[model samples]
Target: MREGEKEERTQPFSSPEFAPVKLGGGISPQLIAGRKAGKAEKVHLVIRRLLRQRAIQEGKAFLDLGTDSFYPFFQQYSATQQALQALGDYAYTARWYPSSFGLLQLREEAQRFLRTRFNVHIDMEKELMITAGASQAFDALSRTFQGECFLLPDLAISTIHTIAIANGARPLRIPLHPVSGLVNLQEAARLLEREGRPTIRFLYLNYPHNPTGVCATRAFFEEVVAFAKQFQVLVVHDMDSWYQAHISGISLPNILEIDGAKEVAITLLSFSKEFGLPGLRIALVAGNAEVINALRIHNSEYSVMLPEPCQYAALAALQAFREDEE
Candidate 1:
């Protein structure tokens, strides 16, 4: 027997100084054994296999649609190559917890831009929060509010349903009047009175609505806001498509502009449709301080801070727009 082998054989197994040999890197043998025999590996394998199947199915559907040749018209003006180049230079994770709301300069810029463009005033520090996107802002608001019943337009985006469901809320779809292409406020009021249990807590409004391209008039928005205030129900405004259309004379009034709106309404805005930077994932929420704070808290708990690079890029884009206007 070799001298080392003899010493190893004689060594006490009880010695605290002696540690088990690491299999790969610093991974212990027991962990390696567990990984080889664990249900976690099987679960991950199943998920990966299912994802592959979904991808194949989606590819087949795309092929059927002939999407390869038919490029859908994008609303944003930037070209694909330009967008890709911009993204290649973007670095998103240089800050801590995303300033608990967002970067101050970006928020200030957003406030100023929205105010100047839409004629709606927002306090950057008190009433606005920078979010991952309007999608996340809506989600955070819904989660924090914890309502039982939600009223939304029939033509609302799928995200409304998803956020409602995730927040333990039941959704009641109110039809958009075909003639006006706006939420039938009378019908919505009736539905709110009829389907609303004591737990019914809120209603959702969308303008320049999705799937159906209909914009609401100022009078209509005022009426809706009044109804929500009367019923003591919160209102969530999905303004994702606000920038998609240009209305004549009346500078696109946000729900925030309606009388008593700030008392009961939260407005969501996205950078995706407006700037054609969907992947950049910048969005904001403007509303009453209580509501905004609730969302901020929810965000701090459930979401990582928005990447600083995304905020900086969004700032740059906003500055470009301002310069263009000048």
Candidate 2:
């Protein structure tokens, strides 16, 4: 080690879900090891590979957070279980190919669910799309984006960072204000033009946001839409608000509902939270018809459509649970 060279220190600590932590600012073990190994990029991927391997091999249960899928009496409490069960014979002869976007009924229910719950209306045919899961949707979006640089929050699910890096998009990490816990849109946008690039990529936002529960208001979303149009940037809004318990005086608004949002933004939605169906991998990305068309082509060729049974399971989920238990 060189005497004057500074070593990056990684501090890893466990915290409750919805609680903010300062891990991204601190170096991660993988990053530090990657630098020390002298094969930085390769080493980073290797460590991530090993971590995922360990998670699968050990069968560690994530009970405190993101554990909505865990229920002791799985079928016993599930209203959708019967619906899933009824398809025992039908599964044998179900259609092999699901519509590229999604099934009509599922999209219909999803649209109604959003409209009734949050006042966000998603058009089933042209606007909404069903994907395997939120992660896969983000993975595709990171690559589908036409620009070279995107923004990442200082703190978020680690996978979000990996998706951007894996797709060759530079992530401009924006720090959350200590008091507000909000990403400064102005500061983040400023960094986009810092490099004087001709085209700036999308700003990916997750609200009722992951790791941090901070949410944006309708008015703020309007500002974001204006900001995107002003700078000619695309906004990727991940409203993965599946696990939200209703908070008094707070409302969840889809970015699409804001006028001009469809011009510049695409929102991601998931049925994972309510249905306890994460493994089933049923989620939707809706809004921005052009991006949807682009994604439709990319997804049809590269993405594996979920098995036909999963679609039925998704329908059962949307039809079954009226309460947000998660």
Number of the top-ranking candidate, with lDDT as the measure:
1
What's each prediction's clash count? 1, 1
Among these predicted structures, which one has the highest TM-score? 2
Q: How accurate is candidate 2 locally (lDDT)?
A: 0.66
Candidate 1 per-residue C-alpha lDDT over 218-315 given as tens digits, one digit per residue, 9 for 90 to 100: 89888877887777778888777445333234446688888778998888887776565676788878988888888888877776478777777777
Tens digit of lDDT per residue, candidate 2, span 198-217? 46567778787776678777
Lowest lDDT sum, 10 consecutive residues, model 1, at 61-70
TM-score of each: 0.71, 0.73
In order, the Cα lDDT scores of the candidates are 0.67, 0.66
Error of 2 at 301 (Å): 1.9
| Model 2 TM-score on a 0 to 1 scale | 0.73
Q: Which stretches of candidate 1 lie over 4 Å from their true place?
A: 1-97, 242-250
